[model samples]
Target: MDESRPTPATPPAVLADHAERMEKLLDRLLSPQTLCDEIARPERLRAAMAHGLLGGGKRLRPFLVEQSAALFHANTDAVLRVGAALECVHCYSLIHDDLPAMDDDDLRRGRPTVHRAFDEATAILAGDALLTLAFDIVSSDETDLPPTRKLALVAGLSRAAGIGGMVGGQMRDLEAEKTDRPLAIRDIEMLQSMKTGALLRYACEAGAIAAGASGDERARLRRFGEIVGLSFQLADDLLDLTSDTATTGKATGKDAAANKATLPSLHGIDWTTARLRDLVVEATDLLDPFGSKADILVQTARYIAFRDR
Candidate 1:
């Protein structure tokens, strides 16, 4: 990594365009019903699924997938479908994460958390359904990706969402809470990297593969993904310290209450803020080889690090 490089300033206008494209893609991708009529118990499950998956969020993960595909000039529809599948897996994690036994939050995306909107049993089953259906969507015959690449994307996503990745991270988070451990800064970073960053990294790589990216390009994007994922988690931790509930669209100060070690909590706001800036610079530098083609991605990575909400 270069010791110094200017971070790309994401122009408000360009950010708006990216935001608009992201919103439209999310609407189209998530609009499809989860359980079809052919399924015997569609309605009940569908309601539970929609309760958490629908409504609004940043949709950042899917947006990363779409933008990364654009980097390779690939089929937007293929990327959108794959991105949507990733969103399902993400939504499932959030649903399970907010359960009474987990984060215990009653709010998400400006609405009730899944268990609050429906029964706990239904929420549990809905999360399970989304998790299984995510793989189904990727592996289904309808996915337009080539067989080899399709298998690769499926494998990458499964690994990120499973034991070594997101779930394992969550387990560590809970254990941290129980022990009241005052974590080292590096340990906190690792916890979020595994818990939150893993799937985000996978989303970007999956998009690149969907576009038939070369081996070198895939490796470059992986590095970029890892940096941006850490930046996002750091920003989230910073927000927990500074933002209000209304601004964040969720409860603030929850991290401190849960005894979670976070960037600002561990390193102080000034240091964490500087750390975030460094990461944005690092991430944008990685995009230099792609030149002007990756300008939007570079800008978005900055946005992920700096955006207020």
Candidate 2:
């Protein structure tokens, strides 16, 4: 769902600000004119893409990309564009995930899912267009990065979004549902790391690529990304157990309904929440070398762990 403005209680100043900026930028990016406006652009397809992309969500993946690049003082434009590309992939995944063949949900971001708003075929086509558009945007000359960096971003994104990463994990998730065996903790971790963690991990690495960060620096960021993916998975599983559909802005309790194995189902909410807290500390500590420069990321980690939705 769209990020709720931070209150005195949450105090995620950096996240609140970043989320606002990403939303405004994305509004323009998904507009018809930006998406190759043409008399033949097919208004209905464009509309479906817009509905999927412009709808409410945290935009956290983009924020992570941009913030990570900020650590290396990378170009602002390049950072934002990289973040935008990642968001396209993320939004496209959601469009497909909510389809009848996937999660089979009627609601997403507090409104009808793309399939419900339009039709299944339109939703599928829109998702394909958006996913392809992401690569196009990342590789555009307008991104102003070197050929080497652009290639790195392209190759990395392909792997993250493709069979070795997100797709592989999704297939595993489907298999988990079909089998009679209960998923072990390791199984859930492996499943979640791929299904949810791949894009998140790529977001950080993309930032490093944007800045031409040193191998040591990139490695550190990559590890940080891994931690983030796991942390986000735990928090999400917790939300599934505790939050209502309205609060989450999407269907809740679907995991149990679908018999999908989630970490929270194996470990109760109290334990999962506690693990999330520990992860917050570990994530921040990983940034100690950067000190105050990493404060925003530290707070972002805390927000991810504690968000109500």
Candidate 3:
């Protein structure tokens, strides 16, 4: 059942198409009928959740999931569901991250943050709902995955999104910000990997799990995810340094203002750029086993490294 085929369109086009489809899917998934019984979903809460979730993004993590799954010819419908679940977690993180307690940002994806648009209590509830909904989507029968695979996906996502991963990383970042001394390179790496890289890594790993890929293949994709995750953070730091809010659709220069220890900040712009190129080369090399079937992922790695926003 290998669904791999020659794609005539360029990589960016493929990514755009994927993003469009994912947007539509999310719109439907967040609707009243699809989320829960009508009586259980409160009006304002649903609106807040939609405001946060429907906000525009590149949808890069889900693209990673879908492309990774394609390498193994996994079921299209099932993988899309998995991608949606991952996106729920991603959006949830953004909502909570923008709260007054966290980064305290006023804007997200070119719109007012959920907490700013709605009350803080409602924003908190929306984030919690999205996080919980991600698990429900993966574990529910609608995913079209076997029980064992579903369990594995749930476990992987929880670890990536929970403490000892993203949450732990966030704690470290907050602590680092409080101190006058800057974090060491190793400490910053660990923080970034956990906070920003965990779910992205899981995005690739989850695809392999859904496809029943061999351990070696799974491990390779996991490593690729790790590299891409690092590159992603580096690029983000660069954008924060160089781009404006108008271009990035979010606040810029917050990292330096907060004294955050990002690789681009630690190393100069030239060094960070070189490192990003190296990471992309390394990531694409890992996919050589899949040949042209992995072209989209290869392009995705480059995009992650060089994206303006």
Task: Estimate TM-scores for all models.
Answer: 0.89, 0.91, 0.93
Query: How far in Å is the alpha carbon of 263 misplaced in model 1?
Result: 2.4
How big is the positional error of residue 219 in model 1, measured in Å on the Cα after superposition?
1.3
Best by lDDT: 3
Ranked by TM-score, the better of candidates 2 and 3 is 3
Q: Model 3, range 78-192, lDDT digits (tens) per residue?
A: 8998999999999999899899998898988668999999989999999999999999999988889889988999999999999989889888888887899989999999999
CA-only RMSD, every prediction = 3.7, 4.1, 5.5
* Stretches > 4 Å off in candidate 2: 1-11, 243-252
List candidate 3 segments past 4 Å from native: 1-11, 243-251
Query: Global lDDT for candidate 3?
Result: 0.88
Q: TM-score of the candidate numbered 1?
A: 0.89
User: How far off is residue 19 in model 1, in Å?
Assistant: 7.1
Ranked by lDDT, the better of candidates 2 and 3 is 3
* Candidate 2 weakest ten by summed lDDT: 1-10
Model 1 lDDT tens row, 1-309: 333322323433444454466556445434444345444656777778877776666677877887788888884667877877888899999999999998888888768898998879989999998888788778877778889988998899989998889998999888787785587877777788889989889888887899999998898888788888988887788788888988767678978886777778877877877788888788888888778988878888888887775
What TM-score, to 2 decimals, does candidate 2 have? 0.91
On the 0 to 100 scale, the lDDT of residue 23 in model 3 is 91
Residue pairs in candidate 3 whose N, alpha carbon or C atoms collide under 3 angstroms: none
Q: What is the C-alpha lDDT of each candidate?
A: 0.79, 0.84, 0.88
